[model samples]
Target: MEIRWLEAFVAVAEELHFGRAAARLRLAQSPLSQTIRKLEKELGTTLFDRSTRSVALTPAGHAFLPHAHRVFEELELGRQATRATAGVVYGTVSIGFSGALNHLTLPPLTRAVRQRYPEVQLSLTGRVMTGDGVEQLEQGGLDIAFVGLPIDPSPVRTRLIGREPLGAALPIDHPLARESAIDLADLADEGFITTPAAAGSALQELATQACVKAGFRPRVVQEITDPYMILTLVSAGVGVALMSSGVAGIMPSSATFVPLRGEPTYMDHALAWLDDNPSPVLKAVLALAEEVLPTPER
Candidate 1:
């Protein structure tokens, strides 16, 4: 039966008097009695025993009362849930970050999101290579990504969040590590450990360009994907590699990070997302990024 029919049935069942039930429902007596009669006919059972002066529930009316009350209860709960969800930002937002950049970026951004938009769930994917992050964003898998640059402009939009000085990761016992800052030329004769150029590591280009500018081509002995592994290889004296100064925060003790001397070199970290991304939560996140992330220093 219809919900209004059930409402009428419940009101009449409770009041046990047609006039009183109509008054409680804010309906006129004739319409209220007609609604109850229609409900009983739809259910194929008599719901009330009525006389000129009194009205009382039949056995079937007693049996249906509790179930009818439960239906209304469920409808109320559904309304409450809808209202609550409408007032808050509630959805899952997948965020991707390259492993190398997480130490410098993810924690602060995550903290700010948790504080400001707790209703928005964060699905974090770590070790997402810069290129992979962009691809994920374009494919609708990632809502936002913190990635490295040398990123060619595409359908995805990017905003520079931070720029860090490029530094050399050297073995603790390496002669260059003794200096406060080491020039790129100081490592001219050193074999280098680096991520593959095809892996879309922005530092790979920076390293190659800086070395060429320093008048030497690096002899890359090991090509790795993970920055931590690159550090491990350098610690074992595999070779020197260029990395952001922030790497020092998570670098293993076996390696030392020394700022590169001479003309300054920088690596950019940016927030990238599909230009057409339609998530309202993504918009909220970008606004928060503006507030929480440091402005990129040229």
Candidate 2:
């Protein structure tokens, strides 16, 4: 039976009088009586014994009253849950990123989101991938991604939330490290620590391209996967690699970071999500990412 029928049955059962039940339900007496009859008809049993003067629950009405109460409670809960999910409350947002994730000021951004949308549970994952983290977002596995931007994406929406300039991760005492500002050309003959090209790391590709623009194809002395490993290699004098300016934050004490000129550097690093209807939590996280991530001086 319909929710209205159940409500009328409960109201009439509680009041035990036609006029009083109608008043409690904000319905007229005749309609209230008709509603109770429909519920009884649907159930093929008399739920209430009604006379011209008073109303009383039959055996079936007594049996059904508790069930009717529970049904209305469930409907109320469903409406509340709908409202929560329709907005930003009570959701778990999954975010993905690449190597420069830590460099994008995400920890602070995440903290802000936690404080503001406390009900929106956050799950953050970092993967070193060969593709723009956009693909996972498209497949509904990720709500947003932080990665190098100005990326040519395949049917995804991207915001360039940060800009990390090119810097060198070099041993502090290395001859080139002494330069106040290094040019890409200065490192043309230097050995390089490279990441695997097969993993679709755009940042690694950008570093190699910077070397090419500076007049030398880098000699890859090591192929390491992690950004931490990249810095370690540089500190040990295995090679000097072009890196995000924020690399300085995680660099070893033995290494130095210097701004590079003519570096073919990237100014737009990205936060990306699917082009489909996105969740409000994703939107909030994007706003926080945009707020915290810094841009280059253009």
Candidate 3:
């Protein structure tokens, strides 16, 4: 029998009266009764016992009630899942990023995405949001990412999200920290802690550019992977490092932050996604990113 027949049967069984069942199902009594009879004939069992004055369930009706409710529940659940996928309200997206994401716009962006699309889980990978991360996004391994600019930009589309002022991380007692704004020339003689060559090039590029702008090449004393480690090295007076102001939150106690001069060599933060043909979910994420960032003129 058709699902309509099963539905009519369920309503009639629940209400135990032809008129009330029809009212609940938004149908007329005669049609509802006929539909129930058809279902009973197909199943070869009567679903209800009716008299001129009373109505009751047959043993078969009791057994079929739960099954009918379950079928409808499962069907509705399947429909809801489909709608959520279409709207990107529910799905898992793989994301890749560097260890120092908390140093830029990424923190609030991820937080906003989580708060709004609670069902769209992000499966994060990679310590640096760079080459491999961009490649994975093109390969369908990642959906969207927060990364440094000046990437190869071969297969991925990127939007410049925001720019934050770069800061100098120096020992609290370091003489350069006394400057109103730390000039790159001031750090020229100071040893610098840098990021790994293979992981993230953003930090390395920032240091190099800042020093060149200041008329000297920075002295790289050591390269470390973790931001906190870089801070610890500075705290121990190994050298100073340059990065966005957001890095201030995770700095070691011995290190103090000082502003960078002449635009601070602000790191460009971009959101990267597949360029050839982005998915609906990716489109939604890009739109969300745009909303979070302000317009160019503003």
What TM-score does each of the candidates earn?
Answer: 0.69, 0.66, 0.65
TM-score of 2: 0.66
CA lDDT scores, all candidates in order: 0.83, 0.73, 0.75
Worst 10 residues of 3 by lDDT: 276-285
The whole-model C-alpha lDDT of candidate 2 against the native structure comes to 0.73
| Model 1 stretches astray by more than 4 angstroms | 1-85
Superior candidate under TM-score, 2 versus 3: 2
Query: Higher lDDT: candidate 1 or 2?
Result: 1
Error of 2 at 72 (Å): 24
Tens digit of lDDT per residue, candidate 3, span 216-256? 98888988766667888998998888877777777778888
Best by lDDT: 1
User: Per-residue lDDT for 40-84 in model 1, tens only?
Assistant: 889999999999988888999899988998797567546545645
- Pull out the clashing pairs in model 1: none
Model 3: clashing residue pairs? 98-127, 98-128, 98-129
Cα-lDDT of candidate 3: 0.75
Candidate rank order under TM-score: 1, 2, 3
Clashes of each: 0, 2, 3
Better of 1 and 3 by lDDT: 1
